[model samples]
Target: MKLHHLEALVSVADAGSIRAAARLLQLSQAAVTKALRELESEQQLALLVRTAGGVSFTDVGYRLLQHARLVVGQIERASEELAKLRGDQAGKLAIAVTPLVMVTFLPETVSLFRKQMPAIQLEIFEGLTAVALPRLREGALDFGILALAAALTDQEFDIEPLFAYESRAMARRGHPSAGKHSLHDLLDQNWAVNFTPASYESLMQDLFWQHGAKIAPARLHSTHSYSLMLELVRYSDMLTVAPEPLLLTESMRNWAQPLRLDEQFGTRRVSVISLRNTMRSQAAMCFVDCLRKVIRTRSRSASEANRMLFDRLELLF
Candidate 1:
């Protein structure tokens, strides 16, 4: 019936007990009980069934909980929007990013964004698209940069393609399999891969299978942290699959080398995605623009560097 009642209902459901919910809501147990009773009386529904251990939702209660989540989410978003209007130049911008983008242009983009919007607070969540996209939809993130298998529809999100990059096998320079020309050649060595969703793992496996080599699951080392993956490849004979741009980083350039394979490993499409109907704050818009500019500049620089390297190779030949 009231917002507090709804809050109490949701909190109780989450905490699984009246006592725990009271502690979470910072209220007395009696007050919480009174609120719940008032709410039930107003709605004329048995929302919860009490058990010896805790509580469980009734059929109608389960449905109401879903609506309650949306209502609470909307209220929170509204408060944030109002705060942004009041603070014009300052607000929080939350973005989720995949590891590839984090090691590529994100550092430069963040540095430039700080200079342009000194008052804005930036929060970054690092993960794969599967982990980030649900948060994006739930309004926990302003936007996200991730690799997608297919194009997103306008009805769900506004997506801007930042870049498309081919996945390459990389290892520390002078590794035994560095000179290998096919997946079959490296099948005996241990490998590292990003700990993404199952679909991504399948995609990687499919690539190897397409090349007539199937990587054994026991030989694969999966990690969620890029730094750990890099360290593993640098210190050990472990090989990893990564975007080519990631290998060009200053920290990785000297220590790692891309393995030239006889077959293509396929390209991934990375895009910046935001909820279509949501109103973005000024800080969010500024950050997105900065990201676009940085990616464009990096793309141009990479192209130029490649051209220079080709010219030198031609002279040597």
Candidate 2:
């Protein structure tokens, strides 16, 4: 019936026991029990059944717990917004990003955003869109940056296409295949492929197959960590795929080289994805602006080699 009642019920469900919930809520055991009882009385439903180990929610109780979580989360977000409106500049922004973005532009964007909104807390989750979308829909993420599987419709999300970059094959600086320009020359080498959604992976696979080459089962390794993939390429004979800009970093270039593969892997679209119904807070909007500026600057200053590469691949847009 009351906020505290909902809070107590949700906490108990999360903590799995009244005593644990009391500790988590920083309230007395009796207080937590009383709140749960009062909530049940008001709802006219038996919410929880106690046991020696902990507790279990009744079927109805479990259903109410889901609603309770949303209510508590909304209240917390509302409080954060109110604080921001008071000129506190203090709020939380959670962003989900693909690993490519994490390595390429996110750090610079975060740095610039933090300088402008120092009081705002930023949480970044790195994953493919498939992993991030459900969380974004559930209100866990404020926004995301990744390659979309399909064009966005206004019914589900507000999608803004940012930029597309060519995917490049990378190898250790002294790799034997460094001078290999043809896909056939590199087909025999081991590979550490970035794990994207299946749709994107299929696209990549098609690129190779279309070029008369196939990534061998014994030679392929898949991962979501850009750093690990880079390391594998650096320390071993493994090859990996990444955006040209990511491979061109000075630190990365010191250990690895973007191979001049004669095959085109087609540009991947990176976009900003946010829930359609959610209103963007001032802080969230500011961060999005920061991201846009960073991308624009990088796109404008792309190297001549990258420019030519993009041009050749028809990815200049």
Candidate 3:
């Protein structure tokens, strides 16, 4: 099928009606309908059925829709790639960042990315693994910085690992469990955990198992909202497992204390992921580069401080 045919099909699938798709493409509804007809005629299969609201994809149509999405997405990326090669500072990059990243290095990444690609537009939003994966598949998002239980395996996406995340099981200062020096001692407390469909709850279970316990907290609550989870820990007896970066935020640094457990969590990671076999435009790479630079800068600062302390101890000896 022609580019316009695939475009029309993709638009209709997204916009739900020929009329609305026309609005999106800035074309007449009749032109869109004509394109769809030409496509179906060539395929020799009925792709869509009319509905009172608009149209619905036929069984085969549903399968074809994915192909259309990929083709359409590739074309857009091709255009961006060509523009980038020509040294043109245009086109857009859309990315999703998890809440942990937002509170930590996002501002630095944004500033650094803009210094490299000043004219490129950026669209970023808060999303977790569940919201990000499907959008990545649909070509709705260009890049994602997502939290994962570990490095993702061979999926439809290419993963560039950022770092292994360190987590702390924490509670409000003066919490009874805060002073408990072993996971076994805190086992009876209620806990609020951050989890998504991608299964970060397993991280909590792993926390106990790593500490030589076989079970999770006595009472477990799962929440997707970081603020909600933190507030629960602050106001109530609920403790929460949070990324170490989250604990460094101004509000949490003052209000929360890490549970004095003998056991630490194993590896969870935050990484940059994008659709595989697709062109990564210059702007997208620049953003990833900036993210790395910020992480390095932060790491170096911490290392230098440790070095200074070590040097002081050398003089003492």
Which candidate number would show the highest TM-score if scored against the true structure? 3
Q: Which residue pairs show backbone clashes in model 3?
A: none
Q: Write the per-residue lDDT of candidate 3 for residues 125-183, one digit (tens) a residue.
A: 67666566767887877889987766348578888777665667789998877668777
Q: In terms of TM-score, how similar is model 1 to the real structure? A: 0.71
Residues 1-317, candidate 2, lDDT per residue (tens digit)? Answer: 89999899878976879999999999999999999999899889999998887889999998888677656766777788888778676688888887756766778999999999998888888756556776666566778887753333546788877767677787888889889988888768888765445445564555576677876666777665666776788887898776666655554856777888778776667778887766767778888889877766665676884464334222222
Error of 2 at 87 (Å): 4.7
Q: Which pairs clash in the backbone of model 1?
A: none
Clashing residue pairs in candidate 2 are none
Where model 2 places Cα greater than 4 Å from the true spot, the runs are: 1-75, 86-88, 98-108, 127-131, 148-155, 179-188, 196-218, 296-317
lDDT of 2: 0.75
Q: Residue 233 in model 3: shift from native, Å?
A: 5.0
Runs in model 1 deviating more than 4 A are 1-74, 87-90, 149-156, 297-317
- Candidate 1 lDDT over 129-185, as tens digits, reads 656776676566778888765433546888777666676888998998877897888
User: lDDT for model 3, on a 0 to 1 scale?
Assistant: 0.77
